[model samples]
Target: MILIESEFPIDWVISPLPEEEGILGNIFFISRDYMQFIEGLVKKYKPDFVVEDKGMRSNEEILSDEDEFTAIFKRGGISYRMVDIPEYALNYISSPILNKKALIKKFSGEIEEYKRRGQVHYNDPHFQQLVMWYEYLKEDLKAQEEELRYKIRESWMMMGILELAKKQQKKELTAFFICDKRNFDGIVFLANELDITSEIINIKKVAKELEEKNSVEEVIKSSVLEIMPIKMKKKEKIDKILYFFDTDEYCSPFDTNMGYDAGFDVVIPYCKMTAERVAKLIQDAMFSRKVGAPTVFFVGGSDVEESERIAQEVLKSMVPPFEYPIIIDPRGAHTTASAIVAKTLEIAKKHGIKDLSNKKVVCLGGTGPVGEIAAIIASKLNANVFITSRREEYVKDLAKSLTIKAGKKAKKIEGVAANSDEDYYEIIKDADIIWSVGKAGIQMVSKEIMNKLPKNKIVVDINLVPPYGVEGIEPNFHDEEFYPGIYGIGALDIGRLKYKVESTLFNKASMTKGKTILDYNVAFEIATEVLFGEIIKISI
Candidate 1:
């Protein structure tokens, strides 16, 4: 958890005498004069323990209410400790203070004495000033104690709400209480005032507007701005990275909320993101964590170009030799596409699906994006390949350009007309294997065509629509032998291969130094490794 303490109020600082344990959570106090505000904040931000800075005061200026500075963790069974803030962490987010040396000397001496002897007598002169501060706040002290109790109860409720979020499947609910920064001066006073409590409240109205399911930017624009501090750019910090592999489809903000609900110290979303805007949005999500580590990113979106750019930008932002963990391709398209075809070739010999020596493999919709790549992989595997497109001219042009790029003989490349199922069948009938790579809804193979396949024919479909590319085929179809005793592969089986390859590549990607672009070959190699059982099972 990345802890953010915008400012710490000096006046509210009090050296609590340990009844059991010192406060142990992080504190982000912002004002000194408003005791009421501090009182409320202490409850609202009721940390595990606090590293409090008790202020210097004359004997007459000290608060005398022992109850005002009550320690109720014992009664509630909550252990907390308050210690002096470390200078390194303090420099980044702490408030300015006066007479630092004197304060350090005073507190350090007390800490040393407390550590040296288990018991420090209250009657000792060293404890006199500490006793005076407690006495000064004693008049209003009882009310403060009540406020602390209320906060502990509220913290328990907050934890419960988080638990409920985890139990609920597929929905994300994030809560934030926004208030005016001007009112910050009266934070301590506000804590004392009951009326101000409700003003800074839950995110009901904002959540309602977002529930309408508009875009993320719209919700962010409509809800709150106080949380984002302009001019607070000390530097764009990249804390750490989290990876999600082969499960990008189900990876959404709601999924991220689930992680937060589960009490992850810091949950950074980093899978299935495919857009550039998502990269920037992840940068913003870094602000939410507030206890351990620095601000990190949550990178997930559904646009490929954007995801690529984000990968680039994130690498650039990281320190030299970047070496940050980034997880992409969990959705399984870019990585899986290359992997499936490559793996097929690796196992082709064992399956008796051989003879790439001048044999042609027709890729239906070959000019289409995925088909084009499938053709390239087949060509690289030493198969003479013919690519077809609805528009014959486009197929011709693609083959011509690819011939040069691949450094293969241009004569091995061939193009033909294929605008519909009939044209598709005519072009693929003589080929050894038929690879279907088209839009989800388009059906290319019929039952009659299946019965007509050669005895040793091999067919692979990468479509995941309602009706499988070949009728009677299930998405997760698995059998020792496929349709009519001819070898066949379904979409989900390929999807599993895709997932395994994706997870492995993402794990390896975490080690990349900077500006690494995962290309077709990277996917091809990973898929080959997965087919050979060189990689572990893919994660969801």
Candidate 2:
């Protein structure tokens, strides 16, 4: 059934289901959620095109295989639009685009092609070694090629579809893979060692062979000592050059060893490749365990347009299933945001400033995540938090949300929305602590404002720009108890926290056997534990 609403309709449409021959072209059927989302987009945006997700199936085909779908529409007539399915359409579509029998046939055809003698070739001895290695790996991996492929696909689909959804919404997205550092380091070390060992062996053999044959001495003796003064023969062309010491070319046995040593079983091939594989392993474990809710965070942009590029890059790096909290904090925004606020509170309490009961904390660019988080944290600490933004509307809405999120304590959250230098200076005058969390090059608070503040006031600028947001604080400045009465911190202070937090989270995640959600609470708890020195240092 076609759902219609009128306000602003979607401009374009894309169909993920592949088109087939026969009677399935005319019909469009999709899940209720997809349909609703489309309906909402149509009503709100009045977009020129809408991608229909479901296509038709022939009655005859349906009778034979109830799961089959025919073909997709070349174009959506009238108000509708049709576009090619994103490459991952197979996973998102409700019904199979190709029949099971046809799929099998196609796969068999591929296998047949690979079976051709010329198609897959290696030295016989090498091939045997590879086969033995494959068998050994298979025992450990515990799955056949097909099963592994399926797992990768499932994981990729889970990751890719969410990314696709974000693309539809035009939101910023990021994808990353995490792995055991030890494993990767191990591989690199092993590969390098093998290469070195082989080189040394080959070099020693050649040098020993060369050193034993003293052509120079033999020639001198034959020419000078013989009664007939027999002239020594010229040296052989091969012996004229010292090839044993040549390190320049792949002809060296060492370089050849490197190729064998650096394969997948070695250092995971590449950092990104290893990350992708580890991500797949984690995803599969989660899928099998089925214990936790999964979340993917697309942090930076409000719309999907710019974020799609980053998302696609991440997806390509992953094998199939790219699953995890893919948070895109452009410029370390969210990570920095969460880290600074959390760290400041801990440091403050440790410094004997117990209660912020009546103090005012000013956050520049407070509408941004970092500034906003600072405000939230201050409010939680019972300190009055003042937020600033360039746009009044933005600051107002952000403050309201924080207020709502903080409930009764949100009343303590105040804000000023200004777009110019004068406005920025005026906002920080009463600030007990001034936080700078804005664009890279922009200065939120001037030196004049910093001077105007009470000598005892805390001026902590997280900005690392040359002309920092708070003007005077240098990027390299860390506690060192700088400025007598005034406290200061730079980007590095927060960076340390970020690294520790990430390391701890990675370790915690590694220990989890199944799919696990890395949620706000999880991050929060982990951060707190790090602050309290509860978590043990991870070796890798």
Candidate 3:
């Protein structure tokens, strides 16, 4: 005989029974879908008699009218019976033999203990209620009640089956015992105790197996190839890996964390990397992977020139199909600069300044990596850009180099010295956009100088530390008027956009199927899209 088990409402163990002893609890109604499932099983097994848990009985006291389970058997001309513990025995077991209040308090303490031990699922509403009832029954009623309620009922059901088997003059009788999942183990143990042979069938597992078998059969029937007995080859697995190369002595935690968050399966970091060593690492990584497997390279460090060199080396080392996507954002300069320019342009357009073309733009302390990239981006937009530093000669030479990189033959960028407040005032007097991309904690423009600047100008500061690069602009201000007509964008506002730009680049590099070089140009494009919902392309 096969046995079927289902989940039980644990609360019923501690709840009061209905007034009529023969009438089962009203909480035991089966859905139409599950009734059909049980009917299918009954038809397949073709049992002479069907025995169900007492809770499945209808309230009708007459034998002519049947419950849902009894009706299923009656339609097939089969006999049916319901089994449960006797009313007198139930009343004797449920008597006040133990302290119920103390048991509840103990259960509450156990719940707190489970929470403290990090078993947090006990705090869920359904689980909490289930545990409350189950624990209460186990503690208050003791072992005798449990045996009477579960074991005795199951034994009576088995006796009924044996009596039917003998009446029908059959040597083997097949029965299906649909009991609660909580009492499944107890029921099986009792069957072994009485030496009754039975098989357990998990309905859900059997249904899943049948579904999979049907799917395979359908595929075989629709196949073009001739059916034959052969073992199918297993498909190989490929992992997406990112090779992160940092020029510094150690890899930066910020970049590695972003790489993992961007969905790379594995990230291998190499610190103190040089261009000479990058070729061998790339070759080793690419040669071992299958074709079409995602592999990416990331170049990062404080030294922008060294990072660029390493990136170029990585590209050179790869053969045609093995070449992978690479992201280059040294010291976050590329993305930061992109964010700065994109934000400036976004604010500029709002103020009726359609574009950066022919606008006078000044970059304070602009000889640094971030300032240098920002200066180039402004120049590429056809703006007349000026980069400043304390050292005049160094700033001028760097400006000349950046002018060539910006692809401007007319030399739209120039360098100036800003060693004093007068220098800052004179330089930014007619500027349409003033950016303070200086070293942290260094005040590039004092409040007096900011007040002296022209009205209707856009100002930005990238120094989060105080005294800030621009004296009056707060780090979190975005498009706020610090002075009468001067709109100021602060360091923290720019930083938020910079983070989005960098993350998008990393995710794209990880997902690309072919070779992609993510540099300042791509960073600027992504920044524009992220900030304004559309790409604003600069045609240089």
Candidate 4:
């Protein structure tokens, strides 16, 4: 789990014992004001152990930018001992004030700077008044800084002492709440996020209780946040996914929502993501996790090759033992291909064709992403696959590339040109499955060609626009025996399963362990399992 503590609102102040001697007017817990911002970061970043400490050093104001000061951790990198702050637990408790001498020594420069910028002339009474005001503010800031430092030291020592106590007594950090203010919404929100009982104990009460406790063990056992994340459940994983879509537009709500529906606890979508950006994102996601992390990656967009390149970069970013599964579905092609091939198998089985091994499958528009993937999956079923294009050279090149990608299944598939009517007739003459993967409204296989083609065969047209990709099958048909003895599955039929298949794969990405890539073959397996195989529950 990665924890990203958002920017601390450094303006929040609490006046405790206003007339108290030595210490400053109010305790400054500048980091505690952003309850909502912190919560949002916690959810979005999915951090395991949050570090909301404002160490006494004023590092947030000086060493880092406001955004940079807000902590961002990759998964499994939550041990933030580098901060070296007191364990800030009970509602923004800071240190006691410094002496007047220390305040002057600490902020003399600041006081002078204020005097230099004052409104009146140096000799004027108003200038004197302005100088006095600067002195007052400087002293106040110095005192607050010292007091915050004291609390920080106390917290650090308390944490060390308490951890030793826990080891000695075997007590859990979950057993305590060390807070100063009970009714503050910010306090309550933090308390709840930490999964503690919001008992509303103020820091003052907590401090008093600490003083009364005789043993160091007793003091730490009762402090929340300060005790460190004790006994975090090693099991029971919550999955998160980073989805990078490379397009001018950020991302469609459809896919992102689908990720959530598929069981991801949080789905962070990034748009217009480049290969370089994806590399960094991959590094962050993978490096943030330890063993059995539920975080994963999803790559998608309209540009097929670019998305593929980014996905490849993501895969390459992971070294052995520290990697997450990635799914590549450019323009919904992977899921679409899975559905198209799965439907063909379904239709074949209905006609008493149990095995697809002997089937002759021909895919029109073979050069396209959808067609190529469909050809690959169908070939995996041992079907004799042939991809056709108007250009013989293009068909051959697509077939070669698809062949390389499909590996052993390459032997079962080939490509040919089907530019003319005679070519289409000859191609579909012995085809058991004819898929029109051409662009929408461009009819490849017409009614006449279907009439001449062999019967008891399946024809699938995944084009919603008219003139349909395939000549005879209706664009709106889900599954109608539009042509006798030949079952035609339309675009909508494949589309429905396409959505289901993608969600199923996402669920698999979250749940599946070890090294696994969810692509067309995996998608097909999941789709078939959902429809016909053992009753696997698919959420969407």
Candidate 5:
């Protein structure tokens, strides 16, 4: 008998069925060291069967203790089977010996090729040790015959293990296989061909001083490092991809620019997208990439309702474990509204107003998307919100819709027709804060109306065009005393916050692990954090 060294290095390989197949456990390929710690592995992996190779013997001592090994399995109630290729079958497949010189040269060339390709595992000490062993074993005819037998036996074992794995998978049970360390790479290659996701565990590297009597629990207790499976090679970093969908005839360049600024490596813009067309596009984008790839979907358009419909379609098309982040900001309305509300809260607190609760807020020309979101946010803060438009019926319907969107128990919002000076005065006279979000270049609140407002009231104008939304309030003003006792916040000030809020949301969506939705509400929370240095919840 040719006895091998007992202190040789060993490796373990674990393969698992895909989660979609409903197999909850892993198939482990363990080394000789595992025999001493079989019970430890059983408790950790909870495998149902243990398979041992009867042909591969490392040393005489282990073979002499075969009875003790079988007794350990029996005492532990572990179902085990010894497997091997029959002597006749092994002889039938044996080939005539080749030239040793040519064989050694071929192996050397393969090792050089692997190194040239920058294979990371080539540097592993255990792998280098295997190469040294192979070089030494090639010198003798007996060693050469053993090597050939080991190769043939490994092929047979792979098939046998795969067959056993399939049987266990049917019963939803896990199996453990013990094989020689020399067969680890071959088994891994076969597992890959079979489409099994395998994890490699180099026993010698993970537990360097593993003793013959050491239990798995003791080894685990001594090591502070987590015993994670080793990846064969480092995975290349996937590109951060962002899909920007617009309902208009042409996609907006603003959103795509911000997407790149937020650190996305690729931003794909889709124009003229509808809810019907978004489903297929979402499915295609999601399935083309590997799982856990950083991806985001941004929705923007002039039409708020159409953009919302497309966003819902995106949500519906995504499957679990593949879902990415989605940001809904129709024409920047969500972020702008959040900034406006957060700024209002900051100014109100500075002016001795505790919160927006029960305070009257008048939104001039508040029927558009930005104005609508602002009104909803104020309503959510328990404010008595009044939205003014030229058309009373349209504004009233919008108010009712926004109230429902806020929540079932939210405060009611009132709509008024501000077609004349009397109507404007009626709504603004009792307001604690006045927001002008009317058409650009149009002044919703004139100097004459501004002079008649109550003292110590806050006013905000979000129009950068000439003849700003609120007359006498410049675009750069921020909480400035525009009138004797009236404070004003300008469009540029709110625009800065809006830019910060939108960019922060994009950054967060790119870095988040699982599916995240960045809507008006999430924007509001982030805005509060950006402005107040922490999130401040304002409830009634």
Candidate 6:
């Protein structure tokens, strides 16, 4: 039966017996003092839809409103707009439109009385006084037509109501007076999160066009969602990652170790797969988790750009606050980038620098994952960071992406082309620190450029492969000063910390019970926390 959670006390529309499928509903109206406990009612009846009779709303508004619905259904596993029962949608003719034309006709008596009073009330008890009383009375009749004239237009709420009714097998939908918008909105919001099956319908327009209701029960004798499917009650009480990689290597043993070291009990690496392939696998794994079990996803590959796109697809598969968390650290970009930033801070601290404010830091080779992530982290640290590339277009694109990803730091970051020795000299004129996280074997900041930098500046190189990431920094150099007074960290220096940072994040995720989006920023946070002895969690 339909459950009308009316705002005002309702007197109309009696509920037909359970046997009568049509016009069957229990009314909770009249002094809607009980409206506050509507959630209790929703829990009690689990109604098809809480039919709110009187309210005005738009589709966009319904989509934007989610807080109330979430608050109402505190727990998960709620299916709203549960099924596509288009049969009711097609069959039902609106009672409002059918009775509208005849309504004005019924008021003919009062209308005539109103006219008669206009003519003869010239001297009742008092002519003007009688006229004023009748005029006020005329307003009631006017309001009647005004209310029914528009007919019933289906807002997003109404369409969802019928579908939900059908899904719950509460096919009896007879509606009322004030649809507080909250009930309608809340139901829709909860349903969306729970993945309710619904189809859009214009019931109001149908009521306007169709003059008569279909008395037939159902011509198709079919069903939509008669019963909700059985769900897994047990949340997989463990954290897992179907760590997908694009390369044939499946995954790096080092990366897999990082996950286990962080907090995951198991890390299953599947290599050489496309986004489409991995998306399906990911969905399967995420769905298998028990109710309270937490899962974290990790996406890593040499192709940082493509990995980010894959991460987007992974996100599309998740139901927020319900699904497991996902982290995109493609090609160790986020990890290494975070480590680079932390190392920079350490160097700054050593030099007695208070903060990076107004400090100029030049990031060489800003097009790679490490470069972009480094730039983002630096910007967050309040550094005046300059990200350079061989081409202006790549710099511009990275600049735009960084601006959005890094927020205010994006403003402090400017993209420049540092292809030539002259470009390097001009860009690094005011540089206090330098980070060279260019592509493997690419000579980004040559000795010519390094020689031009200030004597006391800090420089870091993150390219571990042959040809190194920077000009003067050795691969094994930790925090060593080879360039006069310039302190620097080499590839191994950042690599060791990158491993630690990633491990710390994983461990943090393991300990966390709720969803935690572990990214470069989170990595940097854990890194800094580890440095200050604030982080106590240690994964074996």
TM-score of each: 0.44, 0.40, 0.59, 0.54, 0.58, 0.52
Mark the regions of model 4 whose C-alpha exceeds 4 Å error after superposition. Answer: 1-239, 247-252, 272-276, 288-293, 475-479, 534-540
Error of 2 at 314 (Å): 16
After best superposition, candidate 3 residue 78: deviation in angstroms?
A: 33
Q: Candidate 5: worst 10 consecutive residues by lDDT?
A: 1-10
Locate the minimum summed-lDDT window of 10 residues in model 2.
197-206
Which 10 consecutive residues of model 6 have the lowest summed lDDT? 198-207
Residue 426's C-alpha lDDT in candidate 1? 77
Point out where model 5 deviates above 4 Å.
1-233, 537-540
Over 234-299, each residue of candidate 4 has an lDDT whose tens digit, in order, gives 233344654545553668677788888887777887888777777677767777777667777787
Best by lDDT: 3
lDDT (tens digit, per residue) of candidate 5 on 1-540: 001111233321111235354332222233445455555555667666666665433235344555565566667676666555655665554433445545666667767776797874966885586578657646664555665556666677767766666666564556666655566666666655665544443443354445653687876666443233332442455789999999989888888899999999899999888999988898899999999899999999878889989998898899998988899998899999899999999998899998899999998978888998899889888999999899989989988888887786568988888887777877898889999998899877778887887797899899999888778999899899999889989999999999999999999899887667788888898899998888855332
- Candidate 1 Cα deviation (angstroms), residue 21: 35
The clash number for model 3 is: 0
User: Against the unseen true structure, what C-alpha lDDT does each candidate score?
Assistant: 0.49, 0.45, 0.78, 0.64, 0.75, 0.60
Taking every candidate in turn, the Cα RMSD to the unseen true structure, in Å, is 21.3, 32.4, 18.8, 21.9, 20.3, 21.4
* Distance from true location, Cα of 532 in model 5, Å: 1.1
lDDT score, candidate 4, position 466: 88
Candidate 6 regions off by >4 Å? Answer: 1-249, 272-279, 320-322, 408-410, 534-540
- Please state the error at residue 447 of candidate 6 in Å: 3.1
Q: Which regions of candidate 2 are displaced past 4 Å? A: 1-331, 355-358, 406-412, 419-422, 480-484, 513-520, 534-540
User: Alpha-carbon error at 374 in model 1, in Å?
Assistant: 1.9
Best-fitting candidate, measured by TM-score? 3
Per-residue lDDT over 1-540 for candidate 3, one digit per residue giving the tens place of the 0 to 100 score: 556654333223534556575344454555454567678778778886666566434336325464565688789877666655555655665555335545666777776777698876945895578587858666655665566556766676666556666676666667766666555566666666666665665544212223333476765555333212122222343667989899999999998988888878798999999999988888899999987798889999888879989988988898988878899988888999999999999999899999888999999999888998899888888889999999989999989989988884434689998889999999999999999998999998889988777799999999988998888999898999999899999999999999999999988887787777888888999999997888876546
lDDT tens digits, residues 26-99, model 1? 33233232333334545665533322222222323223333333243333333322222233533432222223
Clash number for candidate 2: 28
The candidates, ranked best first by lDDT, are 3, 5, 4, 6, 1, 2
